[model samples]
Target: MQNRLITCTLLLAALGGLSACNKNKGGKSDVTGWNYNDGKKSSGFYVAKPKDIKTGPGLVFVQGGTFTMGATQEDVMGDWNNVPRRVTINSFFIDKTEVANVHYREYLYWLENVFQDPQYEAVVKGAKPDTLVWRSELSYNEPLVEYYFRHPSYNYYPVVGVTWKQAYDFCIWRTDRVNEKELIDKGYQNQNVLKQELNGGGQDNFNTKSYLMGEYQGVPGKPKKNPLKDAQGRPRNTVKFEDGILLPDYRLPTEAEWEYAALGLINENPSPRRSEKQRGEELISNRQMYSWKNDGYDNLRATRKGNWQGAFLANFKRGNGDYMGTPGGLNDRSAYPADVNSFFPNGFGLYNMSGNVNEWVADVYRPTTNQDEDDLSPYRGNEFKTVDVSGGEGNLRDSLGRIKYVNENDSSLRNRFNYQRSYAVNFLDGDSLSSSSYGYGITTLISDKSRVIKGGSWNDMPYWLSPGTRRFLQEDQSSSTVGFRCAMTHYGAPEGAGSKHKTGNFFPTRRQKR
Candidate 1:
């Protein structure tokens, strides 16, 4: 037994010596992706990527879900329109109020000042106001014609007589301005980049992520270096969209988003699906029509829950044949303009969705939309930038065969699709029966057509007050009845740590129903 123990000890010692010494038989290192030299391993420790994004101001996260998009309960006789269709909508944002006269004027002011070139100047002037809307047939709106747009007093009211195309331009202009300011505030010194260039150049220099990562300071020419070095030991900027910077292409709301927001329906119940069993306390509630509930003056219903004396929530004609309000008491079209923040806000903390100047949405007009469109981000139209022929144009192909035009000016080259001009082209190519094999729906359209408007106006009757009612006009046509609002798409969950207002308490909660 003593002899065996002595042999085992000697074997163990020999193994230990082999481990200490260099034994290179094949010569390949044991480490596949790591290298250890001078004490530290070359590869860094693995880290799971960050999941939730931190959001900043300017984004209004719209909670989305399925809803009866049109009028569910009947208010008028023979009103079979706006059938309740179950559809889901993804989250997005929208401007809280209609674009006011002051805001529109700001856009016009910029356009006039910047693009002094003759070609652009002509187009801008042609799109100016149709001031004749202020002229009442029987009474005097002459004062309004002269003073409504220009007067400092009327600045807060919704801007009227602006075309749909002009409104779109304003949105684009706003995006550029907002991004430009953001870049300057971050200390980017390139004034020439923000300046108006004929084509899109030097614009790519602005990055939202690098700014958030502390790489780009607001001061000019002082971009900081990232603390964490890359594989080569050189610093690298963080990925884009890591910071909550939204590139400004804020558009008008889609018809679906508008209707859903107008309803102000939210998820009150903790239940995941609407089909899940629900308690009485879990149901989502209804929203009223007025900015506030029933008031005396314009009150259509008998009972009134609004403020004292029935003051106007918005500017409008009161009583029968009273286009203007009572004498010496601001006319129907009187009161110069009230402050933008004057009125009561709705359930979602949005002001004047109703009884403000009507707003334009991106939907093409259709009676049976709910029957078709996908619930997610319900929108109907998209006419992006046309293909530039000056560059090496790729061969355009159709399902049938390769498409070739005689010249660049050929209408086929101008538009990608060859769908029918009718409004039936609601869904994408394969999604609907009314698919576009030939042209776009708007391509063949003529007259005052394209672009849809929403919200009731100060000049409209009670029936138009519902959020679901939709109407459209040509992109170039302007009207006193029309105005607009802006919106941006939200990136994540609506309620987060960054939310300032106690969203849960201020607004009623929603629950899925069995």
Candidate 2:
């Protein structure tokens, strides 16, 4: 009886140690040998063990890997752009479909309602898509110009006539809204915010940056129990970066990331296996000419075994003067731009990758991008900026209830040499041309304002359907065939926080010593 009691006491002590290990996950600081992350006022660094990254609404994961980027077919246009090169892209999140008419309308509605004061009319106007883009001298596209964006029938169609700048602004707006909702859900923010505050001529609204910096104190007394507490149990107003609550900002995808995602080559690898014995060779079985996984079939993305078998795969012009097809048996069915989610998705469950509309990417146009870009997560367009503090204004925001920024030049930036050198590395050539208004039809049609656009449109031939095909347009210019989607960076693990057998190299977890 005495021996059993002693063993039981020892076991209880061991369990107690294990519980303490979990409670003090940061362990002790090696230098001072003091407990870290303890809920104390002095000598404590708080660290929250947050859950794994959550996939944001309307986004799909694109696992990264090495792939050949650039023209896979004959360069009949002879632009000499998109030269073949091997590059690796880091994992990221992108919209499952193009930004639809309804989504953009929601953005516009908020802008119009919030910025209603006449002084801010231009702000609302600038965000509007140029509905006039559908008009042409040769063709009578007047009806489309009047109805495409506003009409209820076309709500799900991909939004066209939006400039890259407008799309970028939309992304910023989306990030704030998403983060704001997250805080509200976590009881850090008040739910019943006032209407006047949202549209106040002088009052700023709840933005992610301003909230983090303690500028916007949201509506209080909404939730019964608030979780934001300090050491003494007083309510804390602001959330910190280390909280792991707010998600990364939404932005445009880099050229490499876009191309690699469009390819969706993960389908080439073997399916999930239980053990090493069941696992097949790790290899891509075939190369893809279009976004879909083709197996020597002309109709790559069509339904093969159903009533819709051999149906046209993507929405593109069949030939000159061939938009849809002969009356009854229509080819691809889409005359102009179809609904954003009309077609079949690729291996990544991304819809309309090669058709319906060309999507904007975050890269300055360069014919030799494949040659100039870095092998790892390559991109060209970069304007390194810091929160504008030049006038000692102290983290002030512009009229849009957002943070202002200035270029990280020698004077504005803390690290002068770093900014200029990094600019030289990626942003020099583009900035030089941009500073001079692109010389406007002077030396060349291409300019710094020109940005890379990918995928084919409703009016494009099959040549443009290939994922490797590339094109460019001015950043401020809107087009009837050009639309865009948003992307977000994957912060922690590239393969994501998956099980040992899932994301990365499979390894058995070592058992704890008995």
Candidate 3:
């Protein structure tokens, strides 16, 4: 009541605007007769049912469907890793272009500013991409090591020398930053606090999970702008995840999601044409060898009679010592990784899915995990963790000011209502109790730490260009050939299209025999 009276401006327009009242907002509760978003002492269950979530920036929505997720072409290298198997992928959003040098530099700038204190200097240094990855004992590419990352000339080029772990960390930072912006935009958080934190080098940096879990108590927005209230109709400042404001965590795309996206199979369907009652024919008879077309080992170039006739479509080595084609007719046009925006995009309007640079994905490299993994959204690198909230409201957090997660192991599951098996990285694939074949650092270099790298790099051969073909490297190790892109899990309808032009039939719920 004190806050309500204090905000005389909002009080004047209380009847018109959505001001806090002792009643529900509008919707009646389905479970109970009581109302929702109601500030009443009897029932104060705030609920937010947004029509649809805002798609994250630079993301292209890839519709979910069943696809043959393994090698479409002959595995010439004789690595029986990616065997052909039908698997379904859930709808998710992926970055339209690979993470470029400019994008990464922005992240580094933030880290440098925020973690300016001497104690946090290691955080800044660790985030920097390995610029020295460009050096090779045989090659004279010394200039690239100095200029590639620092120079503005390669701003839009894909950021290489980023390890799988670094790429993963980048995604975590991105999630907090993106969500922080969202809160600021909605007037839930004070926008000036961001600049203040940067300048002051404050440890109270805004993190999405920390904010939601009541860990970080940063500056709140104006009272009138917030307009939230408690059960007693007093002003409530904090925003919750249930309020439908914050976004899902931005993370590395799972290997299945990455491959499914790389293979832009949408163009293969006859989706351009649809009927009144029924939609277009949902069919893909052929498995795509490359991201460009269904054809195997053909001229993947501009065959149409125009200025760009016979131009190379992707960046890949044609043969040994063939980085670029020739002096006059430089096929693929790029000797090294090309500008991310310069590539002729695949059918999904996603650039450099087949080349430019190989990408880091969220998966433990197991040769036959696909055979045992779940058919729906198949993946293998799930080391389950719970947000550690040991001290009630005050939770343990990282240097970035996010919730410090406790590994969801068996012993930690004592007081927990829910459960997830922890450290399942090599559970069925190469565990001591399970299969003893592919011994880590012994029988094979493959280990739980070996993360999957997808899509062929600029120096890679045509055989590696296939979406199904995969390779792996140690998670901590960085390479000049490797880069990464981020992905976000999609909520609501898989179609993404709303009710108006929705495809497929929605049958009525079956009456339960009481």
Candidate 4:
């Protein structure tokens, strides 16, 4: 009995010594030297808190849903390109107004300041809109050609004569600027550092990917109190995308997303609950011919209350030789393209969705895209690429401070599901057996470079006002009647992360069945 008692005492003393050792090792009681609890190691990997994503500048949230993405009116041109079909579009955010001359001028100013060298100077010059687009042989439009982009009066007007490529570049530039500003505002980087870097130029500019990859170093500013800590209790300052602080890339909206946003059919199709006793059926009551609520094309005036009751709801040409009607009691109030905010906004709070200037979309034009593309978030022209990591260490930046990418190689991208391709811009357009089966340039005007343009312009008649009516233009060409808006993908729930849909249980305890 004494021997057994001594054994128990020795065992308890050994346990106490072990507990003391654990306490000495930074107060962690992990026996295996692994900070673990409940069969999971705490490796200091931070799961970021759910962040409420604020809307970006000039953007509005567009609630998305299933819609008939095609001709709401008769196919007047009989092209049959936009065949009626049901497709689902995910919720996204889009610019509230078309990019204006003021915005484009800001971009040009940045380009001129940073890229003053000959090579970049030439790039900046190439991005300039073809001002001669305004010149007409029949009419004296030289003054407009000279003053449209420069005049302060037209600063708020939608920017025109910009090619699709130029517009895309603008989106890229805007994304960087907006993200840089966000970092500055969040106290992650100093504002003075940005100014200094801008003045220095040449690979010193604040590129988002470059900064994230530790390529471009900005002067560290006052950082917010860290919510996470290292094993040694040191505060960590890295920002991850999961935190929702960084936004998705801004790009041209897909053709379907653009049309769905323009239609704003959510107004017609309300939520399921209409009243206490009556539930609204999942149905679209009215088929709209234009972006506005009205069915007729003749009535351009607003029927809603306020001083704007009789005001024009959109900007478009009424008839031949009638751009904005007579000066006295003018119909639409402008001779040429009006300010981006000129007309009343659609149900989604987006301006000039139907008229102002025809906007470029991201889709490569195809007559049968409606039939061939996936019904959910339908789009074309996807070219998969990856960051070039061949230089031993990855995340290398170019001379311009932008991260470089290369076409994803087939070997690295191949999978068991059979998606083997270096690129997918024109995937399945042709087979190895035949060349004439899917001829793009040989038989039809359509090519891989042909992008879709939507909406009508100030010079267009009422027939072009339908949101479903689409036209194609070469990606490299500019036009006096073309402008663009930007769209960003929404990350979380379809309705949104903050949505208050039904949760918990669908039935009461008494109603529950075995």
- Could you say which candidate leads in lDDT? 3
- Global lDDT scores for all candidate models: 0.52, 0.76, 0.79, 0.76
What local lDDT does model 1 show for residue 476? Answer: 72
Model 2 residue 477 CA deviation in Å: 0.6
Off by over 4 Å in 3: 1-26, 40-42, 200-202, 223-227, 272-278, 295-298, 389-392, 411-420, 497-504, 507-514
Per-residue lDDT of model 1, residues 1-514, tens digit only: 2233244335422332222222334222354534322112354322212223322233355556666677643647454546666667766676666777778787666656554455465755865677777777896779888888888887887788878777776776676566556545543344554453322222222323223323333234333533333455543333223222335357777888887776656533344332223322435454344433322323433234543344455544455555447676643334333444555454455666765567788776554556666666666664422223242323222211112222223344545475433333344432356553323355444222466677666677655656766666777777777887777755333332122321223334678689
Q: Least lDDT summed over 10 consecutive residues: which range in candidate 2? A: 12-21
- Per-residue accuracy of model 2 over 328-393 as CA lDDT, tens digit each: 989888899999888778889898898899999988887766776679998887776556654444
Q: Candidate 2 vs candidate 3: which has greater lDDT?
A: 3
* Per-model TM-score versus the true fold: 0.64, 0.86, 0.88, 0.85
Q: Could you tell me how far off, in angstroms, the CA of residue 163 lies in candidate 3 after the best superposition?
A: 0.8
Candidate 3 C-alpha lDDT tens digits along 1-514: 2222234324222322221222344566545666765676446665454335578888898878888999988889898989999889978899999999999999999998888888888888999999999999999989999999989999999999998888998998899889888878887788888987798454689877667656787788864655566777666778765455777789999999999999887777766333335555668876677887554323567676778888888888888999888899898888899999875777678888887799999999988888889999988988876656574555466666866767766776667674335777887777665764576677789888999999998989878888899999999999999999999987655666343323345566898899
lDDT of 4 by residue, 1-514 (tens): 2233244335422431342333433434445455422123455533343333568998888867789999987888999999999999988999999999999999988887787777677777988989989988899989999999999999999999999999998988888899888878887778896677657485678877666666677776667765545545556455444434666678999999999999877667556443234445567878888887554322567766666677777788888888776778787888889999878777787889888999999998877778878899999888766666665343377777787777877787667365677665566554352242445577777777889999999888877878999999999988889999999886544444432422122343575568
Worst 10 residues of 1 by lDDT: 397-406
Question: Which ranking of candidates, highest TM-score first?
Answer: 3, 2, 4, 1
RMSD of each: 15.8, 9.2, 6.8, 11.1
What TM-score would candidate 3 get against the native?
0.88
**Which 10-residue window in model 3 sums to the lowest lDDT?**
13-22
The lDDT of model 3 is 0.79
